[model samples]
Target chain A: MTTPPETTTASTAPAPVLAPPRGTRLTLRDASIGRQGTPVLEGLALDIAPGEILTVVGPSGCGKSTLLRTLAGLLPPLAGEVDRDGIPITGPDAERALIFQDDALLPWRTLRANVELPLAIKGVGRRERRARAEGWLERVGLDGHGARLPHRVSGGQRQRVQLARALAGEPRAVLMDEPFGALDAQTRAGMQQLLAEVLRGTGATVVFVTHDVDEALFLGDRVALLGTGTGRVPHVLDVPRPRDRTAHDDPATVELRRTVLTSLGT
Target chain B: MTVRHLLRLLSLVAALGLWQLLTAFDVSVWLRFEQFPTVVDVAREFGERVGSEAYWQDLTDSLSRIVTGFVLAAVAGVAAGTAIARSRLAADLLGPVLEVLRPIPAIALVPVAILLFPSNEQGIVFITFTAAFFPVMVSTRHAVRALTPVWEEAVRTMGGGRWRVLGSVVLPGALPGILGGLSVGIGVSWICVISAEMISGEYGVGYRTWQDYTVVDYPGVLVGMVTIGALGWLTSTAVEVLGRRVTRWLPRTESRAEAPAPRRSPSWGRSLAGAADPGPLTSTKEA
Candidate 1:
């Protein structure tokens, strides 16, 4: 795959229609991230080509969420740094959106309002924001349920709303901290499929965190197997192109899944 | 009416009947029944007092003082609480001072208020302000502090600054807590206003009650107590109704069967027992 030259500054505009195949390039150079002041994960040297789906899989408490937070600029890096294009990420910016594990739909906002949050924060006009939010809701299969409160929707539907909320802003990079972690197995599969389809041609750089090895392989262009003992991603395996459910049963993917499971000490 | 409303009415009647029975039998063993008025006596006095201009003035005076004080306290308390919870500098500077003052009962401040204010009216208003302020401040602080971090971060990641975050996330997110505080604040304001009026004010239901007691007009005192009780109930109901209207986005857990049951009825019992429960603050989730 041909990767475009890294843009020197953070780009807020949606990717151009006739752009190169790759999305935003996210580079973590000798990065160390942790909760509070202490570092849990260190020496995380990795680069993701723009629009590439990079999934990090590990055991519980392996700091997959922390890595996502660090990249999203929600949490400060304990050491080293994460750069988008060539610009350092010091704090949260609209260019990066984190889809939380708990769905984190504002309890007070309806599904559409929740999805409209980023646009609202950006001062988008009411009519325009509402229309864009409705379009996203429709895109996420929540067309008629925009008026429902976040708590009124099912867990899977809430996650869908969260995805719509994240993507509605047209962020350059999406940081997902196990966005489907709370859903049932069937629902998780459905979400994985939907996310894959929606993100197909956008070329938006994605860093998806998950514990399920099968999910990591099914969705990621590259699966990074993180070790619990050291909190470092020791193995990185590249999957064949057009990664999806069909790719899940590919001989290379099956072999890589076993490698990831073994690395996670399952 | 439903059986619940019937039972509530029955309970009221039973209590009144027991009071009348005590008066009729002149049960003066523990407390003197002769000193207390009968239900009929209180009812007659209520009818006479309700028709009097002086009674109306007293009612209006008590209401105006409590309303003004409560409104001032709600606005100031919410602002202070939000600042304390949201800003580290504000929290450090004002938090400890408020904490020190919070535990001092509003009634206990009556003497201080009397000395501080230029007039007894101002003193009474100050007491009511003190009584309402703490609950509003504390509950708002709790609400603001308890806000999920993701909500703020969600706005921040979307490029929202301090003001935008406050307006869109913090204020609205902490609204249920703020409303909870307002409910408790209004109830406490009545308590302090009545006490302050009884102690120093010239015209108020509380002052009238004390005046009636001094003149041995026992039935008139009961009329004052019932008036205060009804006034407190009406004000608190107004706050709750306003809360419901503003927070319409909140998921209502009320079942069809539970819809007819009044939240205020149980609250009345709780308040009579002296503001024990803080009532519902975060039960906005659909059951």
Candidate 2:
């Protein structure tokens, strides 16, 4: 296995074309979902690879969020099975952690406690949870603000804490639901940078959901564009060469953007 | 605070003094006949009323009933709000029933309470409870329902469960509205408690007020009304203050107004001007 360089800080290199590793992290087999008893996404089949970052971006109302919810087991598949490491997700299993678009930290709880929530649920003792949660806080650039409530932090900082919360749980994968949509352009960029930096080494497969074209390109290893609400498969985009996209936008990155927009019928 | 506010206040005082003067000097026969007891008569009665154990006991009775009913309503209201928000079936099942009962006045429940409960005291408490219950329930439901789906999904994505998400995300986001409801509910509860006592009881501020009115103790009646007013005013203020305290995590003006806005120099000078900061004169001398 040729591991990508730890520091993706290089100015230029071949774009990383991420593929599903032989070991499947999550498999959506003909999974379908609906609201008000109407089908949204139909018979979807996809394999999210271990240790890879996959993103879902598409036009409005195209079931991008629904797809994330389905994988996280927030919704039951109307048709088929969603298996995780050969085990089916029953309902909101802790093995796969989901991050919300807004920072969902209990306003009463400080940053550290919010990050440590999953551990608390698992009944991990106070000391170990605090140490790990603190480490993840620093990783997300919230080292000194652990005692601060969610309201005390900036939006971008709050999202970083949300990220730390998802990562701190040591789940098999991290699911995100347009976590940066609410942030301003500058903050969104900063959060994107924070995510890429923090999730770099962790082997947790991150399945990020967003409708923003630029964002998916900025952070995703492989991008899947959910078809317009008409129910279409978003042909996955293999991130173009010059693997280190942290610093600049390469040709494939721009083409990939055009492809996603076109796929969403924008 | 403004010219309008000052004008409004001056006009109010002027009107009161004018009315008092008219009553003192004997204006119109009908107006004079219907006039409120003199301020002096009301004051003396108020003092005499306060010194009595009966008045104190009535006040205590009404107050304890309100506190109990309000506490019950708050807890039950929050739980119902959460349940209705989370479970669609629960909302559908219970919503219509609550809606059906909500419009029936709590005072109207007196007869029903008498039939159902062992005593009039419980019935009065029940009336107070009913008055508070609907306000809190409606507020909580709407608060929970009005929440942005993005907020819940946001927490769920961040590794929160059904219970955790409700406790951490839904409740806090719904707090501002919930507090609004509690304030309104508490005020309404006090109003209902006095009214309940008035119609259904032998002892209470309301009953005493009615008793004084029956015998034409107009001064005492005026005193009873004033007592109810003061009690209501104090309790409402306390609820508002307590609600504010519990939700201190909310963005109070204190957070924004006290925020250290960007400045080249310390506004220490401004805060210290007749304020409690260290003395600038002392600092300068030390420097």
All candidates: DockQ: 0.32, 0.14
Error of 2 at B275 (Å): 34
Tell me the RMSD of model 1 versus the true structure. 9.2
Candidate 2 residue spans exceeding 4 A from truth: A1-24, A103-110, A125-131, A147-152, A184-186, A211-218, A229-234, A240-242, A246-266, B1-16, B34-36, B154-161, B252-256, B259-287
Question: What range of 10 consecutive residues in model 1 chain B has the weakest lDDT sum?
Answer: B266-275
Question: Which residue window of length 10 is worst by lDDT in model 2 chain B?
Answer: B278-287
Q: Looking at candidate 1, what is the lDDT of residue B244?
A: 84
What is residue B20's positional error in candidate 2, in angstroms? 4.0
Error of 1 at A173 (Å): 0.9
Error of 2 at A227 (Å): 3.1
**Model 2 agreement with the true structure over B1-287: per-residue lDDT tens digits:** 99999999999989767766765665676555354576667778888878989988888888888999888998888888778877999899988999899999888888898899898888888888888888898898889888877556645655567887787678877887888888889888988888888888768888889888888888888888888899889988998887776676554445553345421232111221121322121110100
Cα lDDT tens digits for candidate 1, B141-172:
99999999988887777777889889988889
Q: Report lDDT (CA) for all predictions.
A: 0.83, 0.75
Candidate 2 lDDT over A45-129, as tens digits, reads 7888787889888777888877788788778777777777656766775667777777465665677887887787777899999
Chain A TM-scores, all candidates?
0.89, 0.85
TM-score of model number 2 = 0.81
Please name the candidate that would achieve the greatest TM-score relative to the true structure: 1
